[model samples]
Target: MTLPGGDGPILTCEGIGLAFGRVQALLNMSFDVRRGEILSIIGPNGAGKTSVVNTITGFYRPQQGTIRFNGQDITGLPPHRVAKAGVARTFQNTELFAGLTVLDNLLAARHIFLRSNILSCAIYLGLAEREDIRARQVVEDIIDLLEMEAIRKQEVGTLPYGQRKRVELGRALALEPDLILLDEPTVGMNLEEKEDMVRFILDVSEEKGTTIVLVEHDMDIVMDISDRIVVFDFGVKIAEGPPAEIKKDERVIRAYLGEG
Candidate 1:
């Protein structure tokens, strides 16, 4: 498919490929994420779904092809650079600063905006104070948006698994990204928590206008929430379309559910 250009997709990966030593993890995989859309990447284990996320977010460099975000080429940029360029991600495993409070973790994500040098931070000068206050305000807003105000001061390590996951998401959002890459956002949650996460994700897309590219195993969640679906099998693109169309795809059924 032709990638959306000036009036098109928010993100696009064309002919992306990755290899580890002699093994190929992805082979000419390609897809597009339209602006203000939720696109889910679904596949079985080792189907290169997570690799695609890593490639897009610059955690891993693709051996071939390119990634474009906001109409600019960003292939192989470092992860920090990618984040600064408005791509934010939450890992499948929550990576919270365990010893820190929820608010502290969120505030830490604003380090990119710090104006005070290490010397000024050590001295706690006027500029340092102002930066600290500004970061805190941003953190507070994120906490309120994620409905974590009740636990803002609580240690992230002491929170429940689901809440820790939410805290991780809050930290990612603190970057104020234009695109959010979610890797299995609802992996271990109970039904209630999963529902809440789904609501939060939809709100983030609808209210925040953040384009979301999700790598998730929960078919129910993907089908219910995704505007489009991309299916992979053994590192190959087997199907790409809306969820309803993907659900009826013969290749998807054979690869994921086995042919009857």
Candidate 2:
């Protein structure tokens, strides 16, 4: 897409290896996520795509290599700490309070800004009430931007799959993250739904200037949206380049696209 931020990478992952006992989930994986650009990681079914995201967000610890975000070494940081550092992630499967309304679900994601002590919250005093209003305002803007006004008060579980996925993206937006990791955002979506998601993702990157590291299996969409592409296979990175170069890579063809 010829987006900016070629100065340097915002997140640099080098030689990352993580395993569960004897089962290696990711091995010697490396890539760079540029600031304010979309970088998509694509591969076959058991290619350790999610493992890379989990390790970057501190859900899993890698036995080898280091991760640097915004020029700071953030390897092995806790998930909460990672969030505080402006890196957020969405799960491959939906992760939301199903019984809660969409608004409430988004409000819950605004916990970082809940600056109220027990006393102020208990009495609904100055600071607590002010924080509540501010949080609501922020979340409402996200709702509007995501075009989720109709279902703002609907219970999350009652929404259709596409809407639920949209809400999950909204929750991540509520965090006001500098970098967001999206895992399989459009897998089950129909063509129209996928188009809408692509628009939202592009809007978030261009308008808000947020960096995105996406894990998506849809080759067409990934090649269309991503500024850079990283291909993985059997717990290792196979190729890294822009979409055009990656499409013509011999190793990637043999390993991922299976055209060799």
Best by lDDT: 2
Estimate TM-scores for all models: 0.94, 0.96
Residues 7-103, model 1: lDDT tens digits: 5888889999999998899999888888778899998899998888899889899999999998889999999999989999999888889999998
Candidate 2 matches the true fold with a TM-score of 0.96
Find the candidate with the highest TM-score and give its number.
Answer: 2
Q: Quote the lDDT for 38 in model 1.
A: 88
Q: In model 2, what are the clashing residue pairs, if there are any?
A: none
Q: What TM-score would candidate 1 get against the native?
A: 0.94
Positional deviation of 31 in candidate 2, in angstroms?
1.3
The lDDT values for all models are: 0.89, 0.92
After superposition on all CA atoms, what RMSD does each candidate show versus the true structure? 2.7, 1.7
